[model samples]
Target: MPVLEVRRHTMRSKPGQHLSQQGVTLASLIGNSTGPFDLVWTSEKPRAIETAIAMGYTLTRQSAALGNLPKSILDAVAWPNDLESISKIVRRNNACERFARAQAEEWRSIAGELKDNQSALIVTHGAIIELGAIGFMPNATYSTWGDAIGYCEGFRFSQVEGLETCELLRVPSHLQLIHN
Candidate 1:
């Protein structure tokens, strides 16, 4: 039982808000993820929207950066780069890196405003999760989707320096794999 859980929709042939067979798997995963969440944020892509719907969550808001992304780029990447892949792919021109940072910032800002009674669900890409996690584990970097999927990934942020805290839980056991 995690306080927060972020999942990448199983597999997508494209990058929009469309649902696949994975939706059922995702729904099951959400059911296992927890009883209910106070808020849910998702990217504006078809796949993401579909995933949110399948999971029985209402898509109240969308990340601008996510909506601006071109699906062609997402489809081209294999996801989860190893050392070799990192060597070949890491660069200043990496839009994914840029997007990831922006996404993380948004989530951080949103998390900061949370009240004690509120719990949130943020539906985003693997890269964003990696960027957010960077602050937690200085040495451990999320390099691929597989790494994200295998781990129940998320973060906890404390406001008032040490008093109030918001968490993002990534518990594998709580996730149910679904392909709509």
Candidate 2:
């Protein structure tokens, strides 16, 4: 997720927020990559839907299953801010492990189904990129969970024998921070 557009939401949770300037920059940046996606999946959230549209994809399905990780457990427990701790394990489980498993399964099925040169794009949350990509590649690591992929950046994957491989991909510069 981009800095301004980054956050998590569950089904029926609405932020009532519109696109930020950073988000529009991302859309134009990501859109430049000609995506002839055969199918585009997105969360029902406006950010995800809009991100997909901004990137020039037509949404084929919007699913809650592909949305952000449920934050109920994290909300229930009062935890320290330190990420490198025993408490992080519990947070990681709730926010990452299980959701990653589910997403990896879905990714595997899609990877298996696609033909040569065919592609599917999933516009989803940061957790879906971090935990999910790491789930598929157990050795992957990052300075923090959220840092696994930046806002508007993600992993491209290919699966074989029920395992998927990931390659990090980022949105190109839209020149908002650059002087002309």
Candidate 3:
């Protein structure tokens, strides 16, 4: 079985939407700590591509399934309308949940297709990797995403065929403490 590691792209420059110092830090950390991967994938986004390259992946491929939730969906979440009727709210919420579940299933299918002894690395966004993939993670390892997945944070899964549960290898840690 191969292990699949999913990472969130680190901080990006806002104005130009490029990699930031925090992003560089994450790339350097991964390059120093992790072993060489058999396959590397990044979401079809510049920030994700930059993160993968900085992590020493010279031949990273783009996987749309590993990208962020759709912009319109994200916008809805970020700025939800409080004026919506009950039925409208229910429909919107259900739609978003369905989309997240689909994303998780897609990643699971991708993981199942990996050959033995092949480790796959993915660089993606927080919403997709954090919230979307939470339910797929081992219950013992991660009960919930719970805001632990900050910028560039991620988790690793031991991907075995027919396994509904996976072994969690790493839990993202804060590179710097947020509180005094």
Question: Which parts of model 3 are misplaced by more than 4 Å?
Answer: 75-92, 138-145, 159-174, 177-180
Q: Which candidate is the best by lDDT?
A: 3
The lDDT per prediction is 0.50, 0.54, 0.62
Residues 29-132 of candidate 1 have per-residue lDDT tens digits of 65465536666777776666666666677776777554444454343334453322332332333664555456556766656556765656666665445444
Q: How do the residues 76-176 of candidate 2 rate in per-residue lDDT, one tens digit apiece? A: 22222222331345345555456556766765555555666577777776545454454555554433433335556676766555554455665445543
Predictions ranked by lDDT, top down?
3, 2, 1
TM-score of 1: 0.59
Model 2: lDDT of residue 4: 10
* Candidate No. with top TM-score: 3
Among residues 3 or more apart in sequence or in different chains, the pairs in candidate 2 whose N, CA or C atoms overlap within 3 Å are 1-151, 2-151
lDDT of 3 by residue, 27-62 (tens): 767666774788788888888888888777764478
Off by over 4 Å in 2: 1-15, 72-95, 139-146, 159-164, 172-180
Compute the lDDT of residue 63 as modeled in candidate 1. 74
